[model samples]
Target: MKKNILNIQGVSEISKAKQSEINGGAGWGFGGIDLSKCGCDCAGRVTGPLYCQNYFGCLQVYTCNDSQES
Candidate 1:
């Protein structure tokens, strides 16, 4: 783990982070996780600003078509 210095309010502190990879198996190499969409509904009510499906289900953050903006 290396050291990171943060200056807040003119105060300096050190923070350490673990090495990127431990054994090179699913390590912090693929930019963490990329869960596009679990197809879970949020605030299930309005299908306007909110996304849902009368046939399928609630199209969530990474599920609904980004171009289909209300």
Candidate 2:
């Protein structure tokens, strides 16, 4: 059996350029999430709010659930 894995470099730069074009030339910025659309049951799960940060025209999703107090 033969395995072929393609490694692409500098792909991030290309994505950044594309994202900038989509944002109308604006730099990366925080794009807030819609909590109403959140499916997590945050009642007793101690789940924190969804945090998003735009880095190089990419939207990164993160959660601070671990920092929440029980």
Candidate 3:
């Protein structure tokens, strides 16, 4: 059987406007993790901070032809 994880292999940023909402709020958006902490460069390129748990490997910045995780 083929399993579809949908979008499990990626990260997402909370909407800025929603960050100001009265909910849990975008902690990461506010200042939880910076681009560098997340291992992304100026253009969101991965700087190899990724720890590959998979026997294969996680996608590189250029592997997907882009900086964004997915």
Models 1 onward score TM values of 0.15, 0.17, 0.17
Could you give candidate 1's per-residue lDDT for residues 11-64 as a string of tens digits? 444334444333343224644332342235354332421112322354234334
Model 3 ranges with Cα > 4 A deviation: 1-10, 25-70
Q: Which candidate wins on lDDT?
A: 3
Q: Give the better candidate number (1 or 2) by lDDT.
A: 2
- Compose the digit string of candidate 2's lDDT tens values, residues 1-70: 1122224443333567677776333233555453443342333232333441222122234344657578
Candidate 3, residues 1-70, lDDT tens digits: the string is 1234434576445678977774552333543323334444444354543331211232354333445675
Q: What local distance difference test score does each model get? A: 0.37, 0.37, 0.42
How many backbone overlaps does candidate 1 show? Answer: 0
**Deviating ranges (above 4 Å) for candidate 2:** 1-28, 39-43, 46-49, 52-70
**Pairs clashing in candidate 1?**
none
TM-score of 3: 0.17
